[model samples]
Target chain A: MIKVERLVKAFGRQQVLRGLDLDVATGSITVVIGRSGGGKSVLLRHLIGLLRPDAGRVLVDGADVTRLHGRALDEVRRRYGVVFQGGALFDSMTCAGNVAFPLREKLRLRAAEVATRVEAALTQVGLEGMGSKYPAEVSGGMRKRVAIARALVTEPEIVFFDEPTTGLDPILVNTIHHLILELHRKLRFTAVMVSHEIPEIFEIADTVAMLHEGRIAEVGPPAVIQASPNPVVRQFIRGEPERAEGA
Target chain B: MTERPLPLTLRPLDAIGRWAIAVVEALGRFGTFLGQALGTILTPPFKFWAFVDRIHYIGYRSLLIILLTGGFTGMVLGLQVYFTLVRFGSEAYLGPAVALSLIRELGPVLAALMVTGRAGSALTAEIGIMRITEQIDALTVMALSPIRYLVAPSILAGLVTFPLMTALFDAVGIFGGYLVGVELLGLSQGTYFGEMQSFVDLSDIMTGFWKSLSFGVIVTWVCTYKGFTVGHGAEGVAKATTDAVVLSSVLILVWDYFMGTVLP
Candidate 1:
């Protein structure tokens, strides 16, 4: 449902994505894992036209997402859900209001309809009762779940999670992973999760793409990647403890 | 060891000159921005109540403090001027001198400075906070132009508030002048009123009011631009807020000088 071809993104002199190519298939979970500042977020931002690629193109569905402008661009944005890092919830709003924001802002749905959908999405993320809680009042795990609810509130064709499991406790991480699996089985919507939550991602993500040194080093199923002889692939899958020592 | 400095036309010195030129260019750009914001206010699709609501916040709500400041400033100025003139036994002229200086100069300048402290910093901090938090981005993504929703309301507020603020300052300051002239300094009330009426024309008050109106525009423009253009992170918000206040104050002063020359 999404494609990036020879994407060249740069910040003044330093290039973040040096002619990197990636594709996210329809109704599939594609997890992108990479080192920090390795163009994972840049690539995702390009998908939503938040950060314009210096060159090449990002196609969402069939439209050139990089080329869409104004109302047309916003229309494209409505087609996807984005869960930003740190949740990025509006502090002024409660969890329900946060989820309902896009519905009210973009879809112009009636208040009742918006609330109904928000509750349903919250239930999907196992956050059915925490709707009225403010961001500060909620736990970190709940905030992330609320963010996921906000992302899925639109019932978009695709959902993008910047990092689903980064700050979560083990139990919460497992919950999110199982929720992803459950959502995949039920909704069958396209999901692209950029994460260094390697193990949980392997448990849920059908296709894993590893970005390395400004390009995709490997793209395959979890087992195929596990046995791959590529030094970068092996080291990445070795998880944080070994990698921190390597660093 | 480093060599001597380069000439004005040469690389290093030329860079300083270039930077100076850039600052001037930025000022010109800000002027254009002010013009555009003002133009938008006069054109179609005016949100009338929104303007009134803002004026109520920016002007009426802040009036008490403004009144106190203006009253004290005039009282202080009256005492100083009267006492100084007493040394020459020309204390009666104190009325005309205080009237002219306050109406011609101090009124607008002080009002604008106060607004810079209150509204300009408020606008910058509000928008700057919104910016780093992606609220502005969220607005745009929702098909709301940040310029219309965020900026235009503020510009309208500043425009309406400054003149009203000046009016308050003029009244309070003149009252303070009377308090000092008639009560404290032992000058007659009749003589003080007569001197003020005879010396200060409608044009002098108009000049001060008009100068403040322009100053208000500059204040909102600088603050809104800085807030909307803040870079990522906390430091950027701090820098934007600081730049907004400083730039607004400087613009008010510079425009004050220009009005001094241009207005009657």
Candidate 2:
């Protein structure tokens, strides 16, 4: 389980996260949904230790990740896999090289073992026979798949996806969503994904956290969040103005 | 008595103070990054293969340009010096003049500037693109340090390659001078070669080596630091590349002048 308590983060004068608290249960897919630039990505960065919070403690499995540094922080990070919004696949590397990077860097696996794992991860992402292609040579969807493969190759205990479906068309979005579901079903790693693909993402989410301003306005199961009594939550989910404004 | 604002007429001073602070801050950041890169280089689990690859990239890849620059510079120096020396009845000294100037100054300075324009700009753009594209962040998340994986090899390669390139530049330049002064200008080959051999000293060659070494550090440091701290988006990458090349060129010249006064 991961616990975030009173997370406060500011960039210069702009306070992005203000006393935000969240709990991510073990082996659950917790999808954080918010408006663009509403600190969803910032929160995801903090969770992965990519950005430090100004004031907060992020406890991952009871260890305070924010307090850890150097080798200790690396030890914590080794348990994580992240798929950035842009895929972030190293352009210089082929798909196989990209997937094998973490294994080689962190584990020092033999060449043959690295190859086998790279191939298996590529196959898992439906990218078999495509390992030789560079990230630039691949389509956007294909690059994202390669990124996914790279993320999963390490068999991390936790995975963070940042806007995994941001720029995809509906068909591609559906494909990616299903792919996430399939991977979750197979590995059951704790997943925390920041996305704006509402209603669709709700299908895969075991819990939905709605961030408004810098705090969670509402959080629960999809059905419960769908029926939230909060006006702000309603305004956000409906993507419309409150009807009782005149009163 | 009514109080008067102390800086009402001192706005320029205030602006100057702010500018100084910003410059100092930038310098401190660069120093920190350099220290980090050097520390990573000195630590264990050294990536010798990566260093070798960067040497090829930063040095071997820059050979053609350096050669061309050196050759042209020497030819021009030889032609100009012959004409000027003839008026003073010192035409026999043209070889040493060309050889000495090339060895001590132009070879190291021009080669460094050329490499900065070629390899240094590329390095900056590559790192800046990696920064804006989140590749650096990806490395961090994978438990890799960008300084260790990216900066150290390039820095070490520059340090190792600059003096060697300056030597090559001096050789090629002197040959170009010989071709022009002896072959074309009708000066005896013996006289021209002998003059250069007698006049040029080991200390002059060592001075060129020192200058080129310092130029290498300045170029790589500015370029990599610009790339590593570049802002966001395509505009940021473009700006960083331009800034890296421009700043490194200026700093190389300034450092060369300072080293001229400091080194014998």
Best by DockQ: 2
Query: TM-score winner among the candidates?
Result: 2
Q: What is the per-residue lDDT of model 1 for residues B1-264, given as tens digits with 9 covering 90 to 100?
A: 777987656887778889999999977877766675667677656666657766776687778778988999889988999989889988887778777877778888898788778777877888888878766765554444567666788888887788888878877988898898889878998788887788889999889888988987788888999998787788998899998899888888998999899998
- Alpha-carbon lDDT, every model: 0.82, 0.90
Which residue runs of candidate 1 sit more than 4 Å off their true CA positions?
A110-133, A177-189, A240-247, B1-64, B84-100, B190-202
Give the per-residue lDDT of model 2 (tens digit) for A17-36. Answer: 99999999999999998888
Show pairs that collide, candidate 2.
none
Clashes of 2: 0
Worst lDDT 10-window in candidate 1 chain B: B137-146
Q: For candidate 2, give the docking quality class from DockQ.
A: medium
